[model samples]
Target: MPLGQPLRLGRHSVFPPLLMAPMLDITNRAFRTLVRGYGGCGLFYTEMLNARRLPTESAQSPFWQGLGVERDVMVQLLGDDPEALARSVERLLPLDPFGFDWNLGCARKKITHWGWGAALLENPQATARGLRALRQATDKPLTVKIRLPEHGHPDLFKSFIKLLENEGVDAITVHARTAADGFKRPARWDAIAQVKSWTKVPVIGNGDVQSAADAQAMFQKTGCDAVMIGRGAVGKPYLFKTIINQASGATEPAPEAAKVLEAMLTCLDTALETPKGAREFKVFCRYFAQTLPVPHWFWAPLQSMTLGPELAKRARVFFKK
Candidate 1:
């Protein structure tokens, strides 16, 4: 797949080449809808769901909660057990999602200890077997999210990628850093370029894409098919529009702080429909604070408030400045 081309991933084809990365606790249905409202995100992924929990009947389960079938959403599952992962996919298929993604790039310690998330990257054979199981279990498009090798062993990385390709993964999103490196190290765009050289499958480069210029630079440097924005999309939903405009040689009005706040409030309203409405609102507010120019005096009080209306009023007041 070339950098500016439409890449087919099983039943779906993504154009303009962008995806909203599956962010834990952040990329919920409400946030995905908010990004979609801004326009230009080619695909949207839900937050990572534990494969084990998907079988249980719980209202709070991320898999069961806040799922809106109307949007282009891919549900991401995290688990080390091949059977458990496969069974989870079978259960999720009835929802008729755009596709499914296996998460192999989260570096959180709890997930790593369970042999899930980025720990799967340490064992290429296990990862390949898991992919095979997932491929056989469901006809939906299968994608994997991976991080760059910490030891920089190109041969081993290529072998792992080849296993995914052989197993018929629709696409792969590379976070561009090793699990050990976390988010601190700069994304290795050159490594993505190397992967692009080796694979014909759609390769989506992810990491540190904060602006349209950053997206352009990643495309220019890596020659990958698409760009996936994670934290950068938070409090800045218009980022997708900006990137698309830049790619098409057009310009858009810069997103003002007030508009960003209004979007956050809209996201809050949607999130409130879910079980952990209050807690999720707090998480969203924390990120929104980062995007606003409000003083700590304003944010501190708002964070401590239990009332949603109070928080919204405070946010509006701060944004008006």
Candidate 2:
């Protein structure tokens, strides 16, 4: 059928519940702005911000600079310190985001080494304390993005699910893969189905959804309340708009190469506004390059160009051909 229904997060409601998944280094202001410009994604997420550093992050830093592109965005936090996370939430309260989502799905070594993200799944006590702290920290909508249990940790996974509901999570977005599976394994959408059976909280299914058809299948098969698109949205910012329109029996014009080129450059220009923006622009291009006729041939060129104006000119030339 259609993508899925609108999702409620405490006091907030996001209609047409197709969400953009929280991707570190990828879901910045320029990228979210590009996706929102296309329309379809009901809710968006910031790159997972380190909770401890968030409270002290400079407003002028690249991280904070990109957060203002849209409203109805969720601030995703990563860390193990309850008190620090509480402070971070307090700082974000004034921004009036759609809500806050605690991340329990990242498997990155740098993060898990700190006993945060996916590592918390096996550490119930810490997870409970962190969740409880977040609940007490914000009156705004509070949620989480999580993974299935790790190998041989079935009991731990079940308890983590129970803990989420017990601690008052407004919603849970299941990445639908074990922490060990990483991206090397195809996503287990079936796992999302299982989470639906265990938790009463609204479930948003994420993983391997690259199109409207995939979203439809996830909704039908998992009975999830929403579908979240991650890497799939990188190449085509218009993918969400297309998915939403298809559900309505309407067709959206494929974004023109020139238009996509212009959008990336605009974001690059925005990135160039900050001292550290060049790195963000490069990270952004690695994905945007996928839209080019020959991604392999163009990625190096895109990555090599550092100045926004020069890159914009070259992009126009390359895309026009």
Candidate 3:
């Protein structure tokens, strides 16, 4: 087993340093709270905030709030404009995030159309300009998430990260898939070591880390400082805790799946409310229902059903003890 340890991000301590990757609709306040309840996640990221839209968002919305019980939240931003990205960082100061993450990795066409996300990689100097402005915006720890170039070109990758380090990036998460490859190919776990060798900044490995075993393999095989999980943890929020428990030679099983679902439902009801609650919950259930041990009927219509008395009623019955 690889050694599990704490990571320091600015002033925060990420013990058992497994992170929940920031996803478009998956990492909401309520779901994060439920995930934290199981114990083991180090730092959780908010949704990728559009820098252009950040200034217009209400702090009271779930989009900007922190977990009332924990402070280890990282706010992630994406935008093409250096000025807007910088401005959003300042606007987010009140949330008192653990740090900030620049999304250099999202490949969705919609995000890239605005010259945001992975599209920024097409112009290293432009990426640098935004990074410089972001560095000026906050003294808090800053990180960037990225995917390798289309062919995993060695010189181009190293040159790009060199720019990030020069701009004072605290950590870098490499998703390990080339932009064009998408999910059609398996993540090249071996390449993480190359990044580890090339960068002075800490490297957090991402992509295909679907289980605690995968996390351990990542550490042993790639020597990454941390592993980031997104879809894998959607159905099993106790994933980090399981990794921690197993690493310590503990044989404990995860919290009962039924109890986990109930807690998630409660958080959705009581935690901070957002105008997008319904939509967020739908996206969450899409990943969630497919992963549980429940029969097909338990999840069959969840994607189409509206959340209300119907959803609550079915959950109570489907997951009933």
| Residue-by-residue lDDT tens digits, candidate 1, 1-321 | 123777578877887578998877677766777788889898889888888878664645554555535447888999978888888887777677888899998888999898888888878778987998899998878999998766647798898888878989999898998887777789888889888888888898998998888988888888888899987887677788888787677887977878877876776674554446555666666765665565778867866776666666776787777
Considering summed lDDT, which 10 consecutive residues are worst modelled in model 3? 270-279
C-alpha lDDT values of all predictions: 0.79, 0.82, 0.81
Number of the top TM-score candidate: 2
Model 1, residue pairs in steric clash? none
Tens digit of lDDT per residue, candidate 3, span 117-164? 888777799899999999999989899999876654689888998998
Each candidate structure's TM-score, on Cα atoms with residue i matched to residue i, is 0.91, 0.93, 0.92
Provide the lDDT at 144 for model 3. 93
What is the Cα-based TM-score of model 1? 0.91
Instruction: Looking at model 1, report the run of 10 residues with the lowest lDDT sum.
Output: 62-71
Candidate 3 runs further than 4 Å off? 10-12, 67-69, 270-275, 292-300
lDDT of candidate model 3 versus the reference: 0.81
Q: Whose lDDT is greatest here?
A: 2
Which of 2 and 3 is the better model by lDDT?
A: 2
Q: After superposing candidate 1, which stretches have Cα over 4 Å from the reference? A: 1-3, 59-68, 273-275, 291-294
